[model samples]
Target chain A: MINTEPSRTRLPAVLATAKNSDGARDEPGEEIPQTISPIRTFLMGRSSGAGVDLLFYGVMVLCAVSIFVIVLAIIFVLFQNSALSRHQFGFTFFKGQDWDPVSGLFGAWPFIVGTLLSSLIALVIAVPLALGVAIFVTELCPKFLQGPISFLTELLAAIPSVVYGLWGIFVLVPLVRDHVGPFLLKYLGWTGLFGGLNIGVGLLTAGIILAIMILPVISSLTRDVMRAVPTSQREAVLALGATRWEMIRTGVLRNARIGIVGSIILGLGRALGETMAVTMLIGNRAEVPHSLFSPAHTLASVIANEFSEATGDLYLSSLIEIGLALFAVTIVVNAIARLLIWAVTRGAPARVA
Target chain B: MAIEPAGVSLPDNTPGPVPASEPKSTGPGRNRNVLRSVIDHSVTGLSILATVVVLAPLVAILGYLLFKGFSSLNFAFFTQAPRPVGEAGGGMANAIVGSGIVLAIASAIGIPVGIGAGVYLAEYGRNGVFANFVRFTADVLNGVPSIVMGIAAYSLIVVRQHHFSAMAGGIALAIMMVPTITRTTEEMLATVPGAVREAALGLGIPKWRTTISVALRTASPGIITGCMLAFSRVAGETAPLLFTAFGNQFWSVKLGQPIAALPLQIYIYAVSPYDEWHRLAWAGALVLIVLIMASVTLVRIFAGRGVLKGNS
Candidate 1:
C-alpha cells in the first residue's frame, strides 16, 4: 500500500531531528541513572525507558479519553446552560409553540417539528436518487466511467453548506418559485401540502437543498458498502443466467442492506445537523405550518438566527435548550448509524465464511 | 432445487434461441423479452439521469458563482474591510485573515491531541473497552450539530470569559476537528504493517519510539491530509462562529478579541438586504468554494496514491 512519496522520506528525518533534540536534553553524566535499562515496569514503578514509555502511554490515553470527555462536556455544558428555560417552562417548553422574544415566551415545538419535517422531506427526496447513483456506480457503470463519476459524486459532498445556501438563495429558490413550485402545485394543488403560497423559501425548499447536500453522502457510503460485497457473491448470482439487474438486486443490494440503512441514517444525521444552508433557506419563522410552502425554522436555524440578539436570560437558555435537543437527536441517530456500519463490516468475515 | 436445465428454465432473450417450454409461441415471448429489456434499460437510464440530476447543481453553483462573483473579486476586495451599505466596493480581507488565524489556532490545539488519540487507538487500543468508548464517542461527537457546538463553546469559553472571543471560535472549530482527525489518523495507523512494529521492537527500540517514529511516520501523509480536510471544514463553518467569534468589522489578531471569518462574513452579507452586500457575498462564496474544492481535490489525489486508506 505504500506509495513512494519524496515527502515521506523527510518526515522520519524530521522525527529523528526531534528525537536528537530530546536526547540533547539528557546529559551524558545522567546516563548513570538510566543504566538500569528501564523497560520492565508498567506504570507505578519506573525505569528511564519505562518512564518514557509510560509518558507516551499516559499522553495517548489522555488524548483518547478526551473524546469522551468532550462529548460529556458538550452534554453537560448545554444542559447546564439551558437550565433557566428548563426551570421556567418545565415540560411545557418543548410542547408550547409560541417563540416570541418580546413577551419572553419560548417553546421548542415548532422548531423541533420543523427540523424533523425538513429532514424527513430531505430523506424522502434523497434516498431514491442516492440508491440509483450507488447502484449505477457499483453495478452498471462502464469501467472507464466509474472513477470520474464517483469522483464527481463525492465532490458534491466537499462543497460547503454556505455555498449551498448561496446557491439556494440566488439560483434554486428562483427556479423553484418560477417553475417547480407552480408545476407541483398545479398538478397536486388539491393536496394541502403542495397547495400553499409559494414563497420559495420554506421547509420544502430547505429540504430540497438539504437533499441535494446529502445525496453525495448517502450515494458514496452506499457505494462503499455495496463495493464491499464480495465479487464471488455477484458471480454466483450471475452464473444462474440472471440479468445484470437481477444479479445486483440479489447479490449486492441484499448483502449490503444493513450498511445501506446505516448510510441512510448517516445521511439523516447530516441532514438534521446541517445548519447554514437550511437556516438560510428555511425562512427563519418559528411557527410550524400544515403546508410545505410555509416558512418554518429548525432547531438549528432558530439557534443560528437568534442566539446573538437574544437578550433575556430565558431567551438565551431557550436557545441553548434547542441546541441541546438538536445535539441529542443527531448523537442518537449517528451512534445508531455507526453501530450498524460497524456490525456489517466487522461482522462480515463471519457471515462470508 | 427445481432441477430445470438452464436452457429450459432460464428465458433465452437472445435472438438465436427460444426456450423449448415456449412451444413456438414466439410473438408473446419476444414481446415479454422486449418489455423486460425496456424496463432494464429504462432503469439504467433513470439512474444515469439521477447521477446527472445530482451533478447539475454543483455545475450550476460553480458557474453562477464564477459569472457573478468574479467581477467583485478584486485587489480592493481582498485588501479592505467591507464597505458601508449602499456603497459598491469592499473586500473580506479581515475575515480571510481571521479565518486563517482561527484555523491555525484550531489546528494547533486539535492536531496533536487527535493524532495522539489515534495512536492510542491503533497501537494500544485493539478493541479494548476504553478504545471502543472513545471511538463511539468520537463518532457521536462528529455528528453533533455544529450549532450545538457553538452553544457548548459559548457556555464553556464565552460565558466564563464573559465575552465572545477568537479563542472560543477556535475551540469550537477544534472540537469539530478532533473527531475527524482522530478517526482518519486511527484508520491510517491501522494500515501500517505490524511487521514494521515487530522489526523495530526486535531492534531493541522502545514501543513508544517505534510507534512515534516508524508507524506514525508511515501514516503521516494520510494524517496530514485529514488535518487539512478538517481545517478546510472549519474554515467554512459559520454557525459555530456566529455566537463565538461574533465577527469583527476590522482586522484584529488578538486571541481574546472578537474576530471576523469568511463564512460568518458571507452569512452576514448574504442575509443583508443591500445589493452591494449580496455582490460581496457572492465573491466570498466563490473564494470559499475554491478553497474547499482545492483541499478536497488534494485529498482525492492523496487517497488515490494510497497515502490514505478507506477514506473516500
Candidate 2:
C-alpha cells in the first residue's frame, strides 16, 4: 500500500521517501526489495500515516462519544444509588406526602408541587417581560442600543446562581416580605395565592429570583428565533402598509411564535432545575406551598440543601431518587425545547442550541 | 371626516402608499389609523419599559454588590483564613486558592476533550446519524441541572471512594463544561468557511492536520470564549461542590481531600446567620461576579473582533 498511493506517488518528496526504505510487503510479484526500517516507521507515524489517520479519527470519535457515555453513566449512577428508595417506596414515593426526615417517611409529591408551582410563577412573571425585551431588542430598539443590550443580556445569563441567592436573601426576600407581600395582601388578598405568614423567604421569593435568572435565557433565545425569521416577512408586512407593531405582530411574532414558545420552555427547564437561589429563598421547608408566600421545597433545592447531611443510607437514597426524578424531567423538558427550537431554526445553520 | 394630514404623523406609522379604493378620509378609516398608531406607540413604550425593568435588577445586583463588597474586602479578605465560629473576623483566602485549583483541573480536562468532540463534529461528522446522536446527547447532558451533576459526582466518585475529593468535584465541573464547550466549539468551527479547509487539503495537509492547524486556528477566539464561558459558569456553581469538594474549613488542595471554593464558601457564608459571614459572602460573590463579568466582556471583545475580521 505504500507504493500504491496514486496521489502521493506523484510527489517527489514522497517518491524519494518511498525509495529510502523497502516496502513491508513480501508478496511474490510485489516491487518491495527489502524489509521496512523501524526508525523510518517510528519517525513517520503509521504506514503512510494511515494508522495515524485512523488513530486521530478514533480519538476524536471517542471524545465525542464520551458525552453519550457521561449521560448514560449519570443515569446509571442515579438509578444505582437510588435503589433503596426505589425498592422501599416503589411507586408510592411519588405520591407519598410525608417528608418528615425524623420519621423517615419520604414523599416527593410536595416537592414536585412546590417545584411546579414556583416554576409556573417564574414563567408567569418572566415570559411577558422576556417577550417584551426580545421584541424591543430585535424590532423596536435603536440600532445603537442593540449591541449593549445583547451584551447585558449575556452578562445577566452569566451571573452566578449563588450570587442571585445571596442577593435574594439580603434584598429580594426583604422587599417581598415587607412591601410587595403586604401590598398584594392588602389589594389582592382575596386571590388566596397571597395568603400566608409572609415572613419573606418562600416560594414567591424563589419564583421572583428564578424569573430574573431565566429572563435573559428566554429573551436571548426569543431574539435568536426572531432573527432567524426572514427579513422578507417583515418587508411584506410593511409593504402592506402595516404599522411597525402590526408588521411585527403579523410577520415576526407569527413566524417565530413556536420558537418563542420553545425558548420559554427552555427557560422553564432552567427555572425548574435552578437550585441555589431557590434553596436559599424557598425557606427549605418540605411542604407543598398553598400560597406563593408559603415556604416550600423543590426537588433540586432539597438535594442541595440536605444531600450533604442526609443521615442514613435510606435518607441519601431518597434524595437521590428525587434527583433522579429531576434529571429525568429536565432531560425531557430540554429535549422538547430543543426540538421546537430546531423546528424554527432549521434553515439557520448558526442556531447554537 | 377629519382631513388631518397623515404626513403630520410619525413616519413609522404613516401609511406608505395607500390604494385608491381605501379612502383615507373616511371617519372609520382615520379612526382605525389613529387606533393603530396608538397601539404602536403603546407597544413601543411597553417594550422600552420591559428593557428598563430587566435592567433594573441587573443594576441593583451589581450596584449593591459593589457597595457592600468593597467595604468587606479588607486586606484579610484576600490573604487570611476565614475565622472560626465565635471568632472576631477573617477572610476567604483559602477559598480563593481552592477555587483556582479546582477550576484549573476542570479546564485542563474539559477544554481539550470538548474541543476534540467539537472538531469531530465540525470536520468529520457533518450530517451523520452518529454525529446528530452525539450532539443530542451532549445537549441532554448540558440540561441535566447542576444539582443532579452534584449527585452524580457523589455517587460516582464519593461513594466509590467513601469520601469527598477535589478530584470528584473537578470531574463534575468538567462534565458540565464539556457539552457547552463542545457545542460552542462546533458552532465556531462551522463558521470557519469550507474554503479554508479545502485550501488546507489542497496544500497536501492531512485531514486531521488541516482541521487542527487551519480550521481550529481560525476558530480559536470563539473556542476560547466558549471555554471561558464554561469556566466562569462552573466556577460559580455551588451545589455540585456541596458533596463533591465538600467545602473544607481549613485550606486543603490534595486531590483526595475536601477543598474550599469561592461559590461554596459564599454559599456556606450566605446561609449562616452571622452578620460577619454575610459580609464575607457578599465579598466572595463580588469577586466571583466581577471575574465572570470581566471574562464575559473579554469574550465579547474577542468574539466581536474575530467576527469583524472574518467578515472583512
| Model 1 local distance difference test score | 0.83
Candidate number achieving the greatest TM-score relative to the actual structure: 2
lDDT string, candidate 2, B1-312, tens digits:
021122112334545334442665867887777778789889989999999999999999989999999988888888888888878678899999989888888999999999999989988898899999999999898998999999999999999999998889999999999999999999999999899889777755677777887888888888988998898889899989999999888978798999999999999999999998999999999999887778777887988787676555
| lDDT (0 to 1) per candidate | 0.83, 0.87
| Chain A agreement with the truth for model 2, given as TM-score | 0.85
- Model 2 bad stretches (over 4 Å): A1-47, A349-353, B1-29, B299-312
Q: DockQ of each model against the real complex?
A: 0.42, 0.41
Spell out the clash pairs found in candidate 2.
Answer: none
Q: Model 1 interface RMSD, in angstroms?
A: 4.8
Q: Candidate 1 — which residues are off by over 4 angstroms?
A: A1-48, A347-353, B1-23, B27-31, B298-312
In model 1, pairs of residues that clash are: B77-B91
User: Over the stretch A68-136, how does candidate 1's per-residue lDDT look in tens digits?
Assistant: 999999899889888999999998999998989899988999988998999999999999999999888
Per-residue lDDT tens digits for candidate 2, residues A77-129, read: 99999999999999999999899888889899999999999999899999999
Ten contiguous residues with the weakest lDDT in model 1 chain B: B1-10
How accurate locally is residue B311 in candidate 2, as Cα lDDT from 0 to 100? 57
